[model samples]
Target chain A: MTTYYLEYLKLKKKLRSWLGPIIVFILIMVAYPLTVEFLEKDLEKGFYSLLWISILLSMMFSTEDIFLEDFNDGTLEQIIISSSSFPFMIAKKIFIYWIMIGLPISALSFLFSLGITKDLNLSLFVIFLAMISSYIFLNLFVFGSALSLNKGSVLGALITMPIALPVLIVLGKSIIALQFGINYLELLLLLLGCLSIIISTVPFIVSYVIKAHLE
Target chain B: MWGLFFTPEDFVQGNSYRIIYLHVPASFLSQSLYAAMAIASVIYLVWRVKLAAYLIISIAPIGAIVTFIALFSGSVWGIPTWGTWWQWDARITSTLILFIMYLGLISLHASFSNYEKADKLLSWLVIVGFVNIPIIKKSVDWWSTLHQSASITLTDKPSIDPSMLYPLIGSIIGFFGLIICLVILSSYVQILKRESTKSWLKDYV
Candidate 1:
């Protein structure tokens, strides 16, 4: 609880970190319409694909300095020696990032969906889909961020991008299923299951990875 | 050459199917080598065996080359049989992902100067990436794909004719033998480079 609040406050101080991804998301959303020649229906067609990719890119950017700050300040070493469970701290840190960056991106996904598709039900579903998918991407890129701690996030993002491609495939399929009046819930449930597994394991793996870096 | 030139052409596809001899073996070895690396990763992580670590790095480039051959040859075979070079089918896409993984593994290791840290990180990535292997194996069954399912299975009788089947098995074994030699040669180079500062390595070389 204390750790959670501390992480939240610490991240809260860094306005650029959280606000930057939202701006990136907004830019990507706003830019898509300009790139297309003012075709409303065509803009609708490609909106969700751009939405998902933009969220992924923003999440990648958000985590670019996730561990680097603490690592550079020797704070990570202090936490490691503090007798606290290191993985728990890492997991809590990811949760705060989700609250800050991922939550807003998901909310914007709803507005963009409604603005473009103008379908209330589909936009609502987009909100839920974006919420879960964004969290999953956050956890994944955090793991990537941990792996390439000293190296820049590009290498980290490059290596983990393949793992995230399947999630994008699922997101594409789910949207199609929803449009066709099919059972998209199964796909949503699949993402939920995937999120559960990744949430439990990534922090544990990342703790060891960061420890390896410090060694 | 025996499998390519001498084997009887299929009744339907004819001479175009000859590439199967190379494609099947390369495809088989590509997946097989990753399974081997995953096992080596497990061994290295659990037992901390330096040789297991060495094997993982040694197998990575060879795996990448073989996976490329599999993709290229599979593409060549696709032109005649599937009427296109690529279809984004599950098997093909997953194999392409596998090829990317090999390169990712190699590059990930190269980014780090510390060999020990690189090996540990590589082992974890290999294990996580192993989830794709079973998907690639069962992709045809899982999805309605254009690619064919395995004609050869350990428990089931072979669906292919004996004449084609025999040479296919022979070529797979032949490829396996060739890959083993490459792994040995690669491992030797890995050992020499990693252990270059050691007195034993100096004397042995």
Candidate 2:
């Protein structure tokens, strides 16, 4: 358990290096959404734009180096062969990466859409939407990282986008529905369903990919 | 072939509906090709069969192009009928995402470039991607059924008239045949390229 906690701390230290990029990326995410305020006057589009920008940017930051640093330093080999289970370590990595990346995006989701989304209550809803999206995206990006982690961030973002699309579609509608004052409880449950499926299925796949690649 | 020429124009869709000839068959190939890739990928992963891995490697682009045709024809049909270039209509969006997946697969395949680990990694992607197909199909149905309130939305109609039905079935069969032939031919070329150094090449080439 100390090893797990120690591993978590190492992940935190690795993640701290990402803080500079995360803040810069978050700034771009915030500014880009507001820039679209004039181009698209619809409140829903505004919220959607902000949501996707944060996701895309955060994914780039989170996934690009998710595995590359470890692989380069050869720590990945040690992690794989350790007495600790590999998936446990990967799950922990993903959890910390989400905290460093997703939290800020979700937090700033509303501030980014100040003039566009308009209502404070709905902006809070945007925060909720952003959180679920980032959770789903972090997993998708983690999966993508396993594939192209040695490649650049551009490919990392590219590979993750398609697997991430369903959530984007499902949540886009749910958030749009929320904006219209419609009850989106059903859609929220559907999003939760997607999150659970990704959570359950992707880690195993990631572990397999890493093992296959590393071996 | 008969379906393409002999089918009569419809009262509503007229000539525009004919794109269904391409659309339905392409859609059929989309699902079947993915099924093939998934099966081949599973065989390769479990048994470590090189041929199965090569089959997936060879088949990904063909499947991706076939998916593109379905999306294009569907989009063409939609423009006149749905009065929009793109509709977030569940089926269209879901298929577009599938097409994106195919593109991603192709991109991933290109990056590895015959590395020893390439086959295994690609196989995992194929198997993982197959999970999305049924989910996308069902999610579309569920979303539409929940929202439509009335059971009979224009898009949810259960039956097609015979004139449309027979040709669609014919076109689907025809397209399937074409894809099979194409895959076989491509597999032959793939084998030749991959196995060119083998002394067995003297037997045929």
- Candidate 2 segments exceeding 4 Å error: A1-17, A32-45, A110-121, B83-88, B135-158, B197-205
Q: What DockQ does model 1 achieve?
A: 0.62
TM-scores, one per candidate: 0.95, 0.85
Question: What would the per-residue lDDT of candidate 2 be over residues B111-183, giving only the tens digit for each residue?
Answer: 8765447777778777867766875556656676221222223477636777767777777777888889999
Q: What tens digits encode model 1's per-residue C-alpha lDDT throughout B35-83?
A: 9999999999899999999999999999999999999999998998999
TM accuracy, model 1:
0.95
> Whose TM-score is greatest here?
1
Model 1 residue A4 CA deviation (Å) reads 1.8
Every model: Cα RMSD to truth:
1.7, 4.0
